[model samples]
Target: MDPMKVEVKKIDELFRLDGYLKPFEREIRRRHGVLREWISKIDQLEGGMDTFSQGYKHYGLHFQQDNSVIAREWAPGAQQVYLTGDFSK
Candidate 1:
């Protein structure tokens, strides 16, 4: 099998594991409220915070002829970034 195929399989497994762990962790947090404890342990892993996220996106709100979506990303560390998509076109 190709290296890219192996990589895709690895990513797919990781995503499925995360899906299973989400409910397990949610129940633990619901029963114990151990956010701080988990944070301390999780901090040792690189990019652990990026692994789990909670966000709300306000899409398609009432607007007057605005095909142009003003996308704003709050990243001070970013030097340059560009958006390219069918929506942006």
Candidate 2:
């Protein structure tokens, strides 16, 4: 139970998740070509990881560390959006 082993295991877990998400990602790209294209661009942007992986940004998509949905939608058109959620109250 060495510390290096622990780090390696964690990295392996991420690789597994990356592998698992890879197919779903492809499916997403197929189903939502435009969104997938935007996602690819976002991945290229530094701000995206901050917004996607952490709640440190006040814009774009927000996701938990594990990628559980917190919020999203980079769409800026059709001004005036709403989130009818329990958090509103």
Candidate 3:
């Protein structure tokens, strides 16, 4: 009756349907369990998958309109960082 209980039954039927996967059934179930748990945590923390994936936009190198590039990093423990490259025009 519980929605969360569906994954177990589905996994069982899935393995039964695929004879070739029988050899890896145990490992497959274990990985599926871990994947489900991680999805649940991400859903709770980010509200949804779309928002969670958008987190990548916050960090990395970005280009500006002034023909310059900026690099960003989230290093809380580091006091300073240096950038060395040719970003001139």
Candidate with the greatest TM-score versus the true structure: 3
User: lDDT for every model?
Assistant: 0.47, 0.55, 0.73
Off by over 4 Å in 3: 1-6, 75-84, 87-89
lDDT of 1 by residue, 1-89 (tens): 22222222244465576876554543443434345447656766533565433222422223347564445555568999776667533
lDDT of 2 by residue, 58-77 (tens): 65556678856666656657
**Against the true structure, candidate 1 has what lDDT?**
0.47
What TM-score would you give candidate 1 relative to the actual structure? 0.26
Would you list the rank order by lDDT, best first? 3, 2, 1
Better model by lDDT: candidate 1 vs candidate 3: 3
What would the TM-scores of all predictions be? Answer: 0.26, 0.23, 0.61
Where in model 1 is the C-alpha error above 4 Å? 1-34, 37-55, 58-65, 86-89
**Residue 33, candidate 3: C-alpha displacement in angstroms:** 1.2
* Candidate 1 C-alpha error for residue 83, in Å: 1.2
lDDT of 3 by residue, 42-74 (tens): 999878798878766877887789967677787
RMSD of 3: 4.9
Query: Model 2's lDDT to the true fold?
Result: 0.55
For lDDT, the strongest prediction is 3
